[model samples]
Target: MSTPLTVVCWNFENNGKGRPDLRAAGADLLRRLAPDIALRQELWDADAHGHKIFNEQTRALGLQGVLGAESCTAVFYNPAKFSVVRGWAQGRGPHFVLPPTALTLRYEDAGPDSLPFNAVSYHLNYASAEQRLLEAEWLTTWADKGWTTPGRSHHTLPAILAGDNNSYPTSSPGDLPLPDLNTVKNEPHRLHRSYAGPSGARLPDTRPDTAFRTAGLKDAALYWATAPHGDPSALSRTVNASHTHGPDSRVDRAYLTPELLAALTGFEVIEVDEALSDHHILRLTLNGDLLSDVLAPSMSA
Candidate 1:
């Protein structure tokens, strides 16, 4: 059996310029996913120039996690399930003062195997295409570096790269030269659905097809199809044009290395329509045994 891991990424869209309750709202959105780990973008903290909110809300919601980077880009993991091994942040200078923006994480699960996994959460600058390319280069370079741990040349643990990339996959139109706009002018056709299948089941299958071969690192990431709305039968928020800004776009994404992808049993993305922020959450599940592979350098690359 594959390890069962639920991972998600979301753009809270709260740049500290909106309503005061956004913090609470962001926390509420996470509450719905119940994910083992979560990566968030556009999150502001009291330390940043415009950020007035701290992680108080996230803490209040039982997701009390912290990273060295500022609040704009952050990671939250369940202490009950995993332990942090190593973490760092990138994109911190004034020239690129959006937020720390990128994070590299190494975590160990609580299971007997003590398997480890490396994951990163990043938010790119919403500037011109040229600028985005520079950021994308940085991410690709980092991914290429792989992960290293004590007594291990590389942590082969399944590596996951997730967050509000801001860069659309090749399947979508990333060629457009517009960066000022927050939404994509030509979104991929796959995002049109309001939810997943009737049973709310889909697997991670963002394989590289002819059309997606050159989409950069995004092509390296796979999206797990999931049920659109949570607990469809339960009382939840309804997602529509006005609320989520244009027919709900699944801009947030999660990716795993091909080796890691094969090790997992299932992965899924959740459409948390109304938990806190406008964006929906994503989830991924992996086989617990495969985690052991991560500890071996031969498996990490």
Candidate 2:
């Protein structure tokens, strides 16, 4: 009997900025979704109010939340379903202001079939494409089995990395054109989303997402919807047009290691209520068979 595990990732736009009263609406929406795990970005002051709001909302939804760097990024899981074995934030300080919260979790009620799985909730740097690329490279280390922490602990587990990547994939969906940088009045976005082209023209920089694919991870959305040429309607854009001031594009994403990819059962982008968050939610579902098959010792005959 395989259990379906749902994972959702979202950038709650500074955890519902400018609408403090509506802050809990995001968690309320998440409660309706009933995700087993959630990866969040731009959760401004998640530890604020004496961790009152954050704790209350998450607990009400049966989620155990762990604050990441600057309390901006976080990972939440159902305590009854899983327990965090090892969790920490990576790429802090000069590298990324909101580092990815990485964790290895073990199934709670499983005996020997219990296997560790890795997950990361990341909000990549928004001011520099080069910096974001470096962050992507750092994430690939998990799939590469080269990840090590300051404590000298290492992990080589089937992993899921998700959140606001802050950039588009190397190839936009269906060869669809990205938003024109010339129209983007946001100076930081104009500078970060593109690099100089011929004669100093602006061109979209896709190296960040390319880095993850070049490694061993598969983007869950792309793998489920379409590999090379994706169906744009199916892989809907995540950004809110009003918020961007320019043509909005899909920026939120989720990636999985090979074994986990095989376990993916469903993937979707939920158009969240704008009152709750500006960015749509990216949801991925995988079967629990992954727990036992994640680390296959040898190739099948």
Candidate 3:
């Protein structure tokens, strides 16, 4: 018998913008949520003080992890659930968080020869649809047999990418209505999430999410809500709707390839007291029986 694998993605408004950095609080919340994997963004100075901040946080969460080192993103996994393989960061800064990071790990109890999979933490450009499209293009490469990293070996492991995508998901028409471009409060969403149409009309650009889905990956929330055995109530926004801080939208997401999708068992948009983070948490659960099966293909190979 195998246990469930729980994963979470959060943009915890790091770096104290007119507010104090709640690194401690955020980790405590993650610990309570008890995800087997956690993806984080916007650590502001995550590598500050010789990585004191990040190290302390991960310690509190009881997970071993890796930092993008150059960007403000990180991927941490439960050491007991999987053994660490190698972690790497890709892309250049001034585009996305710390260049987007990934961690590879093979499941525990699997023999040394067992194949490992990867989990990625990424944050797309918040200012340009074109840039976001480019980011998605880079990410879609994972659906193929391998993804090339400039300075590393070809990464061929099955992987999942999750984080603050920052734009609405184009793959699914989520339960919330599209942001109103006409409203003054929605200017950011309009300017960032929409593309100019033929007659200068603003149309929501979904190329980012669409590219991932088109690459044959499943958007976890959408898949969970729509799958026959999934809970329909799980369909909702990833950001807190009641707050006027930004447009009500589901900007955070997790995308899984066929093997991981097959193991997916549960999904949730965890609403936390914003005193801890700006965005809600997205938690996904996968059946370890199915996950462990895919990680060891030699038996069938």
For model 2, how does the per-residue alpha-carbon lDDT over 175-242 read when each residue is reduced to its tens digit?
A: 33577777888877788888776788877777777888888788777777774443345467787664
lDDT tens digits, residues 1-301, model 3?
Answer: 6688889998887643424346666777889999888888877776767987778877888998888865478888898888777655543334442368777777886656666777888888787888887888777665554534333444456788898876777634545566666662556655887778789898767678888888887788888888899876566777766433345678888898767777888998988776666688888988888877766654223
Which ranges of candidate 3 are over 4 A from the true structure? 15-21, 90-98, 145-156, 171-174, 184-189, 242-247, 298-301
Q: Higher-TM-score candidate among 1 and 2?
A: 2
How good is model 1 by TM-score?
A: 0.63
In Å, residue 48's CA in model 3 sits off its true spot by: 1.1
The deviation in Å at residue 136 for candidate 2 is 1.8
Number of backbone collisions per candidate? 15, 0, 1
Model 2 vs. true fold: TM: 0.86
lDDT of each candidate versus the true structure: 0.48, 0.74, 0.74
Model 2 clash tally, residue pairs: 0
Cα lDDT tens digits, model 1, 1-301, are 4456666667666632466676665566567667777776776544555333545645654664554355667677777667775554533333333443333334454333343555667665543333444444444443444445444455434456666544344333322121222242333322321113348652112221211233233322232222232222111111223323333333455556556654455544455445355555555665656655654455444
The predicted structure with the larger lDDT, 1 or 3, is 3
Clashes of 3: 1
Which candidate should be chosen as best, given TM-score against the real structure?
Answer: 3
